[model samples]
Target chain A: MATQIRELIGNHKILPVSMERVRDEDDLYELGMTSFASVQLMLALEEAFDIEFPERMLNRKTFASISAIDRSVSELVSGRA
Target chain B: MNVAVNPAALTTPALERMARVADEVAARYAADVDATGRFPEETFAALKRERLLGCWIPKEYGGEGLSLTEICGLVARLGQACGSSAMIYGMHQIKMSSLIQHSVGSPWHLDYMREAARDQLLLGSATTEGGIGGDLRNSICAVEVVGDRYRLTKQATCISYGRAADAILATCRRNPDAASSDQVMVVCRKGDYTLRETVDWDTMGMRGTRSEGFELVSEGDARQVFVQPFSEIAAQSMLAMAHIIWTATWYGIAADTVVKAQAFVKAEAKKKPGTVPPGALRLAEVSASLQQMKSLLVAGIARYEEALADESLMNTLSFIAELNTIKVSASQLGIAIAQQSLMILGLAGYRNAGPWTIARNYRDLLSAAIMINNDRILGNTSNLLLISKIDVSVA
Candidate 1:
């Protein structure tokens, strides 16, 4: 999950936020995830985990931080994706 | 013949019978047509026979008088079977529809409409100039309209179906001396124009679409002026058409990708030694993406249908915004699924089923998103959203 987050953050061009500082519930938008970047991140997450992130997960909250993205990935992986 | 095999051909039934016949033959012809970069003569004949081309023209002026939704559904299906054929047909439809609505009280307008409906003549759009970026609404192509005639000279870039289309719908800005739409879609016959192939587009996707640039010069009674301002109406109409008409084709392509990927993954799993197969994960991903794409398409179609019923729906910024978003999402999702399918299938997906089959389609499908007005749609959507303060609702 951390690797996935790092890759996503790297691809999204998120800067100034250290990977070490990223918490489970930290707002990704606050860390510089624009709407367009968020969509790209969502796509990356879907591709990474081989799961479908439902429309409900389109909210910024779901991708707020490392833990949130990880939880979503887990849900999708375990029949909830 | 498996008559019920494709219920869409029978149930939805295009404005004409030939469209269904063409639809039946499309799955077969698409492979060869794309392979050779040749227009599907059979499908074009089918469309002509069914009078599907006349659907966009007004009933009073020798047309089927169909709604834009019906027209979009028909073209979308056509786009599914053959991308080249769809591109050619779409160009014709846009010209025909715009001409019918915009050409009023012009002496030769009715005559042209009559020929368009009955003659099976196809139209092509030429607006993209080589040096100049494709901004159709603000084109540099010049037209000098005098009394009842217009003299036009345009260096149009990458004219799709340029060689095959009967007439070219060239967008030109009226000379400073004459009144112009800044962008006017004019109907010029093949003889009236000159085609000088600029560059052979040997590309990865949408390869079969012979989209080479051409030079056009029509000095005589080459074009009948459209009554409506092309800038305002054509842009909006083209966007709406692009958004709705191509939905079915994209859906079909993505659907095919998912199915093919699934089969490959399943086959790989069967050969695996008691573990989750190498291809299983990718197959599942594609399947899920396909589901999302389908849902989004269905929802977008519903909104598009509603907009057709009430033009005021277009004024709703969210509606327009969602339309572009849908297009971008569908394009990306389709490309993603195709890439994943290719990865899972490995060598098989790369090889042609025959000499001229899936190889070209995989290439042609990639060009769908990069067509003229693609960027404009996104930019316009952003502007609208910024002004309206409304979130685009995809669902």
Candidate 2:
């Protein structure tokens, strides 16, 4: 998951920010992720995981950090029932 | 379903990012910017830092290398937040796309594009001539080649970011003969140009664009001419991209209109239950219109992306014209939805400090139908459809 996040950031040219520097509860904005860039990251995560993020999850709380995104994706993947 | 889509073509991520930024900016300065006709410099600065400005520049040029679909989606998001800014960004992307499509073997053009990808430069088109009246007027701006330099002079109307644009993509005619193929698009720096501040920009909508009249009489080396004949298959592809982008912007406006109206009605319904029914009903109608517009825009983008992938599809003028019809349909529906939402929102919406985005977008979105040759696009679609019925063999 960390490697995937790193790869996505690299793809978008979101430089100088690393996965290790990102805390689970840290604000993505503080990590240099603009709201727009976070959306791109979410989309990238969707493509990478082959999951469709519900429009309901299009909020900042769900995408605030690497852990938050991972948790949300896990739930989404597990909620397939 | 796994179609091995080119990563360069999908701007889903970029669109997502830009959409959020747009929302923040819209929330912050939409009212002030519209009321004062002030340029959304803060929004643009945000875009620059976010690298949203380079969303369509090729990856080779340090851009996001996004497809037209993604670019359009991003522009629409921006339009929702600030229409004038979105229009300016759209014009800049189109100009950049044009430069990329043409300009073969020119280091200077490549360097300019590279700069555009990073801090780059701001660009706007000087295509619409003031005296010419319409798109049909042969550009009176003449370009005379002298040795390695070209001198140009002409008036440009409806130039977005005219006063502040770092560079103007000026179009001119080099051939004296009407039959001669001398129409060219040249990239001229601001250093060689003077902006005639005759910008009479008072309008019912898109007031923040600073879209005013300006003239340029400049001298540039032949290398400054980015594109000759000013037309190419890629340029055509980019136009298709542009149409899709315009569609997305309108879709965003319509969506935002419904959102704000629904919020207003929901809040008001609790206090005054009887009057809120119509607002709720209007919200429902606008919501339906927004869904339809989104579906059409996404579908049209997919088709355009597919066409861009296949070189043979450039000849599909009729198909492209149909896309224009989709745009017209979406824009008209969007504007109507916005107007209805505004009416439902009532006096609050019309007030300078209204909570609804519909007030500004109601005017800004209307520009889609009036932008150069938009009406002609509809005519072309109708003519092509008529011809298709008469000549069954046509592709």
With a 3 Å backbone cut-off (N, CA, C), the pairs that clash in candidate 1 are A76-A81, B158-B213, B205-B363, B205-B364, B206-B363, B206-B364
DockQ of each: 0.01, 0.01
Clashes of each: 6, 6
Question: Across residues B115-146, which tens digit of lDDT does each residue of candidate 1 receive?
Answer: 77666567777777756756555566677878
Q: Give candidate 2 regions above 4 Å deviation.
A: A1-81, B1-20, B178-182, B233-235, B268-278, B389-395
lDDT of 1 at B383: 55
For B26-54, candidate 2 gives per-residue lDDT tens digits of: 54776777788877777776666566766
Candidate 1 scores a C-alpha RMSD against the true structure in Å of 15.2
Clashing pairs in 2: A36-B17, A40-B13, B72-B245, B76-B249, B115-B120, B116-B120
CAPRI tier of model 2 = incorrect
Question: Candidate 2, TM-score vs. the true structure?
Answer: 0.73
Model 1 segments more than 4 A misplaced: A1-81, B1-12, B15-24, B58-60, B104-107, B177-181, B220-223, B262-284, B312-319, B354-358, B373-377, B392-395
